[model samples]
Target: MTRRTFLRAACAAAVPASLGLPALAQPAAWPARPVRVIVPFGAGSGNDIVARLMGDHLGRALGQPIVVDNRVGANGSIGADAVARSAPDGYTLFVTTNTTQAANPALMKKLNYDPIKDFAPIGRIANTPAMLVVNPSLPVRNLQELITLAKSRPGKLTYASGSAGTLVPAAMLTHMAGIDMLHVPYKTIPPALNDVVAGQVDMMFTDMATGMPQVKGGKVRAIGVSSLQPVASLPDVPPIAATIKGFELLAWYAMYAPAGTPTPIIERLSRELQAAVNHPGLRERLASLGLQPVSSTPQELADFSRSELARWGQLIRSAGIEPE
Candidate 1:
């Protein structure tokens, strides 16, 4: 089947009606205990950052604690699987990104959880583009300079990536620029960014939400953004497309619970999420982190998730990356 046709067909089957199980029993007073939000990536990732941001507000709104637990591994499969297998009660929710939901299906040869089938969409949180950053001591100051340096060093230069959103751009650059750089994979972004800060790796594409502090701290130098245009947070940085035309990638955040979660609970969480993202103070905080907070309803997130899965798959193939 054509990709669009397959996406439509597959997505049509993902509606709540098709997720068959009846909602499991929840607390007499929902969220009677501390609610746990599983963040598949490590600390400081866009997903983790937003989870804490929204979770704090959600917890306050719900009169319960929102515990953000990081279950990092396998580009998020390990944590995603944990959420997928959890009880469909409202207590255990997931705050995650495309790495586990949309991109992993294309990036992995075998996936343990069905992104569409295994989770109930709660709400979308925010979006952030990536920045190509290098250690401050790296001789190169811009994309071209970095490309020239990579060509000269060839496989001697190393780049680290913790997830697909971070990994694909560097791979695309090497493929498009015709340079050879060694790839070092990590389970999450913070440590990868840490190595870049410590000068263990030459460079990487990091989501702005997590990379901005490092950039402003002089720990790393941001040369280009993955957006078609420059980001407001780092205005002086040009689009990577300006150097290598048409290069762009964005990471997004969303909330979910195991499939079969009660509609009432999902609706309540969605309402709270909408409130959290809409709050003026929270919006300003997210903006400062380089994340654009956009709240979406459950149905909207479900449809968007389905579409993004197909789009990320196509982008992965076009970038010349093979599933592992």
Candidate 2:
């Protein structure tokens, strides 16, 4: 079957007739009150920024206030767990990234919620390539130079990681280059990027939205982008794949609700989300932050999540990162 046909069938099978609710309890007049969107990151992090932007448009479209709540920690697990346990009545939504739904399953030994089972897919929001940035004092001008310095110093160099998106790429660099660097973990990206700016840490792979400002301010220098090809936002920076063959990763955002949410509710939210991201003003705003705004159907998001789980799992294992 064609991919589109397959997705249609999968979505049909995945969504139940009543979504486990008594026919009378399906919230006939759905979204009767303000909806809360839980963001599993710190306030100034990329996920939080995107969540608020989308929330503003979505709230206006739905004629209800959209509340964005930042519940940070455990690589996004703390907030994810809250959403998982919330009422599946379409009131509590999750605006999160692959870190929580895909990489955490592979990186953590145990999780409170099932990435596939505990949440109903809403739709994808956007995608942004990460930038390999370092402190100005790191003495590396480009990817090749960083690789050389890393190899020479071995364990002396250190990289900071606040989430799986950053952590996975850092681990991939070590695995591909046969180099060793100390891994320093943080609760969120801003602080991790802060230390890199202060020269407490040597480098980090951060999303363009969070890292670009520091780069522009000269607090950090971007060596390469974490995509197979250079991104339009950073036209002059080369792709890290140019130095490390086949190295590519992109941080993405998506929305979800607790599992068993009514199919009608899920579909309506998905449509609104698609429209919100496609809004002309919102699109321009996202572009300014180096994010590519793209939306997907609920089924498409589900399929993508499954694929990412497997893809990131393999990469993590290859990097010799043990689950914790």
Candidate 3:
């Protein structure tokens, strides 16, 4: 090669280097437009609340507005599939709860997308425990009494569930405790909880956010929490594991982008999510909703996703829950 031509090529390469710009500095140019954060649930739901909370700060951090698109249906499958099919660009993100990612795989025979492979995990946001609640008017006061009564009546007692994930915990409890209870499914917990408060259903297992309100209002009686240990917010409430040893069921939220998103983008999202969860107001709001903020690295989230998928799959198979 001629020396002049070689020098020209060398200068071309050194231009960006001398300017202190990396080859991938274009990430700094990201968000030249607004980003969309899709939540696969309706408004007023726990997932929706968290998504908005994270989006608000994430928008400020990225210097762009983070729009929360709620496309609720098919137990969050529709919105989840949309995010899975979106471009792998960092602009489109999915803020999802366990219902779509973990429970739906076993509950549905054919999902539009594979939870683990279809998207890149950004980070885990929170884990919320479900409260085992019963109508205050019931003769049974505690979990043991309720189980004993259900055993005596077999399928006479009925329990309500808002979704497959919510039901699976109760189903697992019935199977493990050797009791049979009729299942009453609802579109969401608010309605199911309304029925429970009115004594239409004998019992139900709902998230602390929904159930605690009723329990405090004298609408329902909280028997136990579906956590290995009691939560700080409900210190008096016993852990279900205390009565049914090893009984534990909880739901978690995570963030993801379409598979093949750049690793730098994933890292950026994870950092922003960690920061959002660490914010004092967001942390307090999550705690008030009975959700404990938990931020995990991408690898850590991947491992958690795998473990949860396996655990819930095993429970579904053992309980003989057929896909719809």
- Candidates in order, TM-scores: namely 0.90, 0.90, 0.85
Off by over 4 Å in 1: 1-27
lDDT of 3 by residue, 75-157 (tens): 78988899999999888999988888888988887899999999999998899888888998889878899888998999999
Query: Which stretches in model 3 have alpha-carbon errors above 4 Å?
Result: 1-28
Question: How many pairs collide in each candidate, listed in order?
Answer: 0, 0, 0
Clashing pairs for model 1 are none
Residue 153, candidate 1: C-alpha displacement in angstroms? 2.6
Give the least accurate 10-residue stretch of model 3, judged by summed lDDT: 21-30
What's the CA RMSD for each of the models? Answer: 13.5, 12.2, 5.3
* lDDT score at residue 110, model 2, on the 0-100 scale: 91
Q: After superposing candidate 2 on the true structure, give the runs of residues whose Cα lies further than 4 Å from its correct spot.
A: 1-28
Model 2 lDDT, residue 214, Cα: 90
- When 1 and 3 are scored with TM-score, the better candidate is 1
- Per-residue C-alpha lDDT of model 1 across residues 1-324, encoded as one tens digit per residue: 899999998888887655554565453788789999999998888778889999899989999999999999989999999999999989899999988999999999998899999999999988888889999899999999998998998899899999988998888889989999999999999999999999999889998888999999999999998888788777899999998987888878999999999999999999999999999999999988888788999999999999999999988898888999
